[model samples]
Target: MASLDDLPLRADLVGRTPYGAPQLDVPVRLNVNENAFPIADVVADDVVAAVREAIAGVHRYPDREFTELREAFAGYLGHGLDASSIWAANGSNEVLQHVLQAFGGPGRTLLSFSPTYSMYPLLAQGVGSAYVAAPRAADHTLDAATVTAAIEEHDPDVVFLCAPNNPTGTAMGLDVVEAACDAARGMVLVDEAYAEFAHDRSQTALSLLGRHERLLVSRTMSKAFAYAGVRVGYLAADPAVIDALRLVRLPYHLSALTQAAALAALRHAPTMLARVDELRAQRDRIVAELGRMGFSPFPSDANFVLFGGVADPHAAFEGMLADGVLVRDVGIPGTLRVTAGTPEETDAFLASVARLAPSPRP
Candidate 1:
């Protein structure tokens, strides 16, 4: 008998692997770009009360259709989206995986821009699809020409775009997204996990849903709503796409408790939006301070900013960690991405950076 490790594994997975971000135990955690604020005490109590009310029904199976939660999400977004046009999963991450499973497979291709959310390619590979990326311009702007060229060349089965993209924080305009949707031969997925912080109107790819049968918009409550722990996210698309996702997803994928929590959170979305405004103001202040300190962070429409052209980004990352600050080293040479924390946390991070005495590399 051959050893399990020695035996030949799936050929496709030889070098392919799982995805994760760095986790560090630090006081001021600015990594992962999570909403720095916790759910308000009153709101949290409401969620707790809702969960307790549903706890008695634990023996019963969850709502396989997740209808109530879907309706709540639609109400929260201020869209008259019907349950038929919405689908929910454990998280937007799972929602993304379901999309890949439904559309991506052997011989198919998944397309996205380089230095994106990082999960796009990983999800594509998980479903046995080839992943391709076209690099964004130096300032992290999506190059319509490059994207158009790639679509013409690969003709991918699915294209993923992260708006106010992670690690870069640049938002794509409506025209650029329309161009990609027009060029796509199969499906176009626009991930809007950070849209609330954008300070601009969301050019939801949903607007193109009718015109382009292949468009899907994925959203999450994790960032804007501060419900990361609840693990609920949704996708909006045509009914046909929603049906396909439902078919692929596990029945009862979202727990009854999760549904209740999500609904409660949605009811308070206006309050959450007010909190988002505070976070955005803090983010702007941090970005401006960084510029004054000689760090060139790209103009961001998201909660985090990516600064680069440093002499040693990793070193800076380590230094910040040592000073009790935690951020992500996204491996874009000379660039470190930091999430905007509370005002005090922001000041602490700035002070730590000042202590590093960083000098820009020419």
Candidate 2:
């Protein structure tokens, strides 16, 4: 078998690794911050029926515009957005890819704070856009002045903001978002992938949409909706922005089955999200327990918690993995991330932490 080096790979992709987390099968899996609750049976039945109905017409290309799905999303997002301001793709990844392909290319640049989603740079690299990883405040928070300063210094063609940011679950304030939208000379993308898990979900960038035409807020069904496998993600922006994405999107980008299933899921939104409160409880439990155990857990508005102060992040990870538990060792010094799942899952993780990741020495 030929190694990757044997092929004429893109020069920029040389030595670059693909974005992924461990897919290890375990009794309790929390590495990826996935919503651990199963979908309600009612929602599942509807999804199956919807997919079955879609299968009846699979032979035809899906509604290329995904018109109804967009409308459904607009209704779900409810910021006075219509189908015209909506865009979607296979997942948030593809949605971001479309953004890059449309607004980014050879000579353009994408800027974002560091220790973010980890995929921003890859997406930029994929589109031949330069990726800028700027620093955050020491405590992993950002204020308006800091955000605007970075925007001024980079003068990037696109600014990516991951709210309730990954690996460290801090949500960005609307003030900072406003500043970035005001400062960036080009596009501003606020990724709210975990917005539903935030304590105050109402404090979203959606409020700033009408004011900032350049702003785009991206979201996914993977986290709060527990629809990771369904692979539905979308964005809300000015109608003109949607038109730009249309130029770069693949024809029939979303399949009939996808459209149908997502629409069905939207219909039972309240039921589908029934466990969100419990999940939030679990997240808070993780934070409080970690603090009691002398680990410094960051404040999380997402379904996961990123705790630091571990003496050996890998050792703690392996120790937990040994006990049939898995958590993320997101590559920050002394830090590890764990998703808040069911109470049972949280018990297993917290127990594992007590055994392997004891209090660090002062």
TM-score between candidate 1 and the true structure? 0.95
lDDT of each: 0.84, 0.93
Which residue runs of candidate 2 sit more than 4 Å off their true CA positions?
Answer: 360-362
> What are the models' TM-scores?
0.95, 0.98
Candidate 2 on 1-362: residue-level lDDT in tens?
A: 99999999999999998889999989999999898999999999999999999999999999999999999999999989999999999999999999999999999999999888899999999999999999998788878998899989989999999999987999889999999988988999999999999999899999999999999999999887889998999999999999999999989989999999999999999998889999999999999988888888999999999988889998889999999999998899999999998999999999989876565445
Report the CA-based lDDT of candidate 2 relative to the real structure: 0.93
Q: What TM-score number comes out for model 2? A: 0.98
Tens digits of lDDT, candidate 1, 201-313: 55666566667678888889899999887788898888899888877887688888998898888877777667898899889998888887778888888899888656788
Query: Which consecutive 10 residues in model 1 have the weakest lDDT in total?
Result: 353-362
Off by over 4 Å in 1: 1-8, 15-17, 357-362
Clashing pairs in 1: none
User: What would the C-alpha RMSD of candidate 1 be, to one decimal place?
Assistant: 2.3
Cα lDDT, model 1, residue 69: 84
